[model samples]
Target: MESSFQSENENSFNIYLKDISKFKPLKREEEHDLIIHVKKGDKAAMKKLIEANLRFVVSVASNYRNQGMPLADLVNEGNIGLIRSAKRFDETKNFKFISYAVWWIRQAILQAMSEQSRIMKLPLNRVSTIHNVGKVVSKLEQKLKRFPTCDEIAKHLKIDEGDVREAFAIGSGHSSLDSPFSNEDDGSLLDLIENEQAPSPDDKIDGYFLGNEIEDLLNTLKRREAEVLRLYYGIDCERSHTLEEIAAKYNLTRERIRQIKERAIKRLKHPSRNTSLRKFHQG
Candidate 1:
């Protein structure tokens, strides 16, 4: 199945004849003309314009490869940004398309990075802070011989002291000791630290297993009893309904539904001892 899917994808790619030979840097005049064509709803012109700018997308996408995402995925996301830019590209705005599109491209890539980082299960804001803090720390360390102080880092990054501390704490906590918090790392300081254990896998109560168990348990019930269980736990029943709701569904009084529910619960909780089955008392 996977091989068939790959073959289909390859065939589809072959249909789109990508002429990389005509690909040159889009000059200001060329970009302006393409914008005019795009505004006039010429999709072919837009495609050509985008193709010419694929190098720019690649250049921007390459910067984000360090964030532990596939470069191909980033480029694909950047292409999405490029398309959005073409769609929203306004000539009236004094900005050049390249200039306007750069921000859009970065936004698209960063947003994707944000989502990818969330697989770690950190909060959105915290993940964003981690990236921003790393960038700030890297730049500051490059200029200064030693690591910058927290106050200096905060002031330089234009973020609050609390946020800086939080970012640093999260970064340190997330990172291995071998990983430098800043670009500059003293061997002595690095040696004192130890890598924390990776988080344990989350425990999820398997819904499929629970559902199957419920189905098997329901099979032990009579037809009416099974229907009652289905109504209480299946599509028709969203909540733990009151006897009044169940009674209304079954066209009976609340008292009648109550009696049925109680009987069903008792039978399910404590089966009768007979030739076919054994009694199992439930707490």
Candidate 2:
């Protein structure tokens, strides 16, 4: 008898498995190339740009780039932005984190300027209001897919329009991270960023339902191969057994066990066999 998927998570898990099934197994040579690319410093590009920006405004990097702020002060303010960007970056978004973070880094620099010049400080309460306003803007930006106007933000925060305008006045316009919230004991706006990683109730319930379909696929392999994989990969075992341990248990040489492990891996990599187990890997 055929069984139907009982819940939405089951269906979602199935789709994720299909995506896994489409993965092409990497060859040893291809793996080396990937390592070489990463080693060649593609990942350091963002860090380099951040360093370059620090030497300029020393506070923020924007149209007002040559404010001649002290290098020590500039690095401090710029790094605050860098840390904030890492905290708030949404990996699933289509754009790069740096593009979204440009304003964050720049805003921190601007605040450094305001502090250095001893500009008029907003009252603590007003600073709190600005922080509240910034939170709404960040939320609404994601929801609306564009920067929300002051009126839109005001409505969302249920605060007055004048208050929103005051927050914007601190910068040439696009400033948010400059708000003076006493987030940590050090008094940074850094604490205002929200954490978005909690899984939903449905995801928790769905997590419990994974694994059955994968077990069914493993059942199709030769008994020895399937059992070996179950132990080697820790599919249903206490923990993954090393190839040598598995060899001793099976009364086989370590080299033979390794060959079996590799061959089984290649077999699982085949699109037809892999697609069968995609449902198992979904969780």
Candidate 3:
């Protein structure tokens, strides 16, 4: 029965791949027309736009396979981003739709990986920063013909050297815990490991529930305020952002970003708000 189920799943996946491959990419003019139709609530145009971009999502998701997520799952998350981009796309923009869609696809894929890939979750901001650090290193390597040092990367990003090192460490690929310790048929690494200090399974479960509750509470804030809080606290992501970084992204001054963040925190702490997450709050 298991073998039969596996075969059926494989067949289904293969059919999906075949369907996506059948979608021809849109030409520039055709893409513009589709965007217009989509803005006017044309479901057919939206479907076409999504179909034409499924291959692009696959391409982007492929780069993230090393992060331990299956390719199919990454592609699925990327598709969600593609649909979101289609809904929010500005037709008046000078750039191509694919270019705009790339950011959305990547953001979705990274967010998924941050939330689901590891037993210990990292913030999405840290995941994104690690990706940026890698890009910088690759660019510098091509220019200098050698791998750049952490200091060089820090200098380029205008951040501390320790941050660059930490990003590199966090971005390192994962290894199987059950893998053999050495070539000689010896014991696996899992046999020699110690996790006494790790969180208890029950604690982890409670934290997971609390995380969901916090997400619900965050929905009470306005969109921009929620975004500010998310970025500032690394609520759903791997790392928090500095006020300056948030300010630059939103085209606001650092002080203004700080004020917005504070206001959002106040809303979260207000007694009138939901009380379910009140116990999770720390002084």
TM-score of structure candidate 2:
0.32
lDDT of 1 by residue, 1-283 (tens): 9999867765654443254435876665677788899989999889988898777787888887867776767878888878877866656543346555664576567656655655388887887877787677767855884446667778987888778766654443222211232344343212221112212112231112122333455566688766764554321231223344567788999778756755654565542311112111110
Candidate lDDT scores, in order, read 0.57, 0.51, 0.66
What C-alpha lDDT does candidate 2 achieve relative to the native structure? 0.51
- The clash number for model 3 is 6
Candidate with top TM-score is 3
User: In model 3, which regions exceed 4 Å deviation?
Assistant: 1-8, 117-283
In the range 1-283, model 2's lDDT, one tens digit per residue, is 1345345545764564454454443332342344344335445544443343333333234344457664444545766876565445444332233434555665566566764453345576766776777688779877875557778888888888777776655422432322221122222122212113332222123232223444565676778877876766445442345556678899999899877765654555456764554433232
Cα displacement (Å) at residue 175, model 3? 32
> Poorest 10 consecutive residues of model 3 by lDDT?
173-182
* Model 1 pairs whose backbones collide: none
